[model samples]
Target: MNKTLQTDLLEIESLLELVKKQGIEYLNKIDERKTSANVHKAELINLDSKGLGARNTLQLFNETFEPTIVSSSGPRFWGYVIGGSTPASIMGDWLATIYDQNPQAINGEGDISANIELETIQLILDLFNLPKSFVGGFVTGATMSNFTCLAVARQWFGKNYGKDFAKEGITEKINVLTATPHSSALKSLALLGIGSNNIIKVNTIEGNREAISIDDLESKIKTLNGQPFILISSAGTVNTVDFDNFNAIKKLKKKYNFWWHTDAAFGGFAACSDTYNHFVKDWGHSDSITIDCHKWLNVPYESAVFLIKEEHSSLQVESFQNSNAPYLGNPMENFNYLNFLPENSRRLKALPAWFSLRAYGKEGYKNIVENAIDLAKYFGSKIKESENFKLLAPVRLNNIVFNISNNRNKENIDSFLTQLNKTGKVFMTPTLYNDQKGIRVSFVNWRTTKNDIELVFKEMNRIINIIE
Candidate 1:
């Protein structure tokens, strides 16, 4: 080994201790940390043949780059549906890196990490009150999860027409129907070689709502003339957190020949709360479902899962099978994750979720989901009461879509959001709802509380004054 490598190996314990202390300090003072970082241009450093040891490199990183790290994981960050990490999740994430196990096959030649992943998937299914008939696997995030599900949907569509799109190219136009899909889902279509513009728009429910209109959806299906299509439905929309009527969709599935996919993502957490679970009733009936562990399970980044019916296992294998590589063995016989999902090799991405599920069972998640919903309602109430702000939509679950009350102030929405984010006390993202400029404040973080809402309210008022 190199001299620096040898030294790092010798002082591994002390190095880990230093890192532990830093982590503790950050988590302890997360609330006080700035939600946004000041713009600073980093100076480029050239590599040298003589290397700095681990300790020296750590010091250099702290001095040059650490200050630029923003507290997006903090409670006041209400941007882009992000969530903070739980203690157990962080512990599991750390161990995942230390172990560095590549989870692939359950009973293969390597470690049993895939078995652990399968167990974690079962725990997730139970938490969501889903049936055991769905087989799930971890992916990078909701985008990849959507990609995996839709890829199989594509193959299934081809199979309906006596064609193999995976073996050959897309032989026919695949009809995809959706209302208010997340941008990530559309991006998945683009990545899957299915044109994003090809989606047939199903009208949303009448009056300020994002949910799909069942009548309009059925009408669109009628136009397809008994053709097999894919229906992409939203369980939780980004701006307003509106859920499509899953019960009605389930009814349509009996009559229409189409694959149902629900992008529940963070919204799937509604299953945890009795008060909110009604929003996603009968969601388990979806042919495939996408949920993000990082968004609501309080895990670290790059974690999401796609649950597809076990009956479609052959279609999934046909969609993602690595047939060229003989070493990988038969995709159908072994039942490996490599043939089931997009990626061939993935880390123990399920470990953090396993740790989180074990650490906090159904009751704990219920409390978390309920607390977030309550906080969103509280914040929405404040927005409604404010003279300067007005809600774009009712607080559906855990997202508040609001805008400046005065129509004349519409042009200032972007500037106001910029200044608000610059305050460093809170962060939110801007949106366009019903062709009007708006801002979205999502409450998915477990650490968010009534106190955080109060702090944000005061900060928003202060920023409003400065902007006005």
Candidate 2:
């Protein structure tokens, strides 16, 4: 064995202790860390013939890279709909890495870690109060979750015309109708060979709303002339957190033969709170739904799930089954994840979510989600009263999207956001909403509170005052 490897193996316990101490210190001071970093460049290091021991490598990382790390998982970092890791999730993540288990087949040669994944999915369903008819699996994140669901939808569409698209390729020009879909869904279409540009755009509700207009949707369906299609709806839009009228969509589903899918991502957390659950009412009626555990469930990165009704299990298998691998057994009789989702070899990605759900349970997540909604409303109220900014739309859920109060110039919006982010105390994202430049602030982190909101509000006021 190499000298460094031997040394690391001998001192593994001490090395882990050092790491645990450092992790605790960082978590202890996360609130004090900058939301944005001033450093942009780092010198690249070349590999040496001899590897550095783990302790020395840790020292090197602390000296060269640690200072540049930003507190993106901290409460004040609101640039995207990012969520901080809860203690329970971090515990699960560490265990997952240590175990290094691949949760694939149920009847595998190894232990059935996939049972943990299955149980975790059920926990998530319970958290959302969704029906047991929906079967789900974990994936990397929002994009892959959307891809997985849409892939099955694509197969269902092909089946409607008595063709197997997965085996023969997508010979049909598939129809996709959506109002204000996240870019990830469009990218998934491009990845699935369904041309992104080929989508039939549905009109959104008039006057500062991102939800689809029912009248426009039905009229667009009329143009389809009874052809089967895929309907991509948003459970929570990125810019305004706007939700489609699901009750109305449920009515349409009875009359139409199209497959329904929703990209709920972070917004699906609304189902956790009784006060906010109406935004996602009838959402379970969707043939498939995508929600990110990393976002609102407050798990680590690269975690999302796709819930598809059990009725379409055959389509899922047809779309993702690996027929070439005879050793994996039949895809139909002996079920496994390798023949289910996009990736063949997947880590026990559901472990973190499992720990988080078990740790918090339903009421715990309800409190986290409701608290975020309260903070978002508090922040939105401040924005509405501020003379320097005006809300582009009302705070319907946990996001605040706004524009310069008296200035419509794009440069002014850019300058304001730049100046605000430069404060390094808070961060927000710039967006284009309704053909106008805007800024978006989302609240999903568990640590965020009214204090954080007040701090950001004061920072915004100070920045605007200086600019004025």
TM-score of each: 0.97, 0.97
Give the per-residue lDDT of model 2 (tens digit) for 407-439: 534357787888999878988999888788889
Q: Considering summed lDDT, which 10 consecutive residues are worst modelled in model 1? A: 325-334
Candidate 1 lDDT, 1-468, residue by residue in tens: 898899999999999999999989999999999999978886696897889999998998899889988888889999988989999999899999999998988785767688889999999999999999999999999999999999999999999989999889898999999999999899999988898888999999999999999999999999999999999999988888899999999999999999999999989999999988999899999999999999988899989999999989888888887888433434446667878988877988899999999999999899989999999999999999998899999998999999888844667889989998988989999888999888999998999989989988988888777777
Highest lDDT scorer: 1
Top TM-score hit = 1
Query: Residue 374 in candidate 1 has what lDDT?
Result: 94
| CA deviation > 4 Å runs, candidate 2 | 42-44, 326-333, 407-410
Q: Roughly what TM-score does model 1 have, to 2 decimal places?
A: 0.97
lDDT of 1: 0.91
